[model samples]
Target: MIASRKQWRCKVNSCRHTFSVTSGTIFANHKLPIQTYLYAIALFVNAVKGISALQMARDLNIEYKSAYVLLHKIRKALLEQREFTTFSGEVDIDGTYIHPAPRKANKKIDRIDYRLKENQNPEKRCILVAREHYTAEEKAKNPLYRGAKSTQVVTFGETQSTVKHFADKFVERGTRINTDESHAYDVLYAILRFMHGKSQGRIP
Candidate 1:
């Protein structure tokens, strides 16, 4: 049997199924054209904070349900294709607390803000960041050096166990690590087999 423009036909007697360009892929079994699917993918990838399904539907002129399914499939495919890499060389680690969005209240009550007060919110979210510092020569040659070097971000409390866990998981042994004078990082010396450097000031 001859294969059509968009489908392939199997020559074997046992398997004569026909499939399109999107066969066995996330875009399969969709009514939209391949170009529309590709355009949606481009929008999804380029969105830094990510786009909602409703926005995607409006942009692609498709139904909300279709957009939702399309976005989910795209995310699943991307997650399946992702790879993890360990960081080496000089790495800077630090943690910062992020305050939750303040609840909206009446004008008079809203004026009494306590967000700036120290220790006002003990359950604030913590963000742990580990960034690889590049040498001068490496920075010059690196194409993605327009901003900071590659960084790994995790959400966890600032504790000795958390710091040590991040180091063991993402950092390679013998790699130099720099951090501020926080007691939480003390566990790194015992657990992570790396050269540790403490700074009195904040890590750049």
Candidate 2:
């Protein structure tokens, strides 16, 4: 039986089912042409500052809804294909809050205190990111090795609990972790001490 590149059948006698190259994957049942998908990916990757759905639509000459869905599909595929690995050597961590602010009340007396955490916008979410730097050996071996070797991002509420959890799960013990002055990372102090003691055989 001849196997076509786009569509093929199983060689087995009992399981001669037919399938295509994009079967059982994120690109399955794609509406856009293969070249368009490739071009979209190129635009997405080349966008250092990031590209919006509207921007992608204009660049790719596609509808706004199509561009938005395609962009989200790419993001979902990346998250689904993640290879979980702990960061070692040196790791940098930071967080930032992002959300569209809600409209205020018409009168001054109706305004609420936005500064207080309790009254702050509930839609706001903090985006936490951790990047692992390449080891000395890696830098020496690879001539074009950039600073960050790998990056992990978390959108689940950023706080002391979340930061600690991320470090414990993603970071390797005895590795140096760098973070900003945000209190969210303050938990790392105790975590570092525990790891250091455990490595030195001081902690049971």
* Best-fitting candidate, scored by TM-score: 2
lDDT (0-100) at residue 109 of candidate 2?
95
User: Which pairs clash in model 1?
Assistant: none
Local error of candidate 1 at residue 88 (angstroms): 0.2
lDDT of candidate 2 over 1-81, digit per residue (tens): 344456778899999987776789778888888888899989999899889999999998999999999999999988888
Cα deviation at 42, candidate 2, in Å, is 0.7
Per-model TM-score versus the true fold = 0.63, 0.77
What is the lDDT of every predicted structure here?
A: 0.75, 0.76
User: Which lDDT value does model 2 have at 105?
Assistant: 88
| Per-residue lDDT of candidate 1, residues 106-129 (tens digit) | 687555456566625666677887
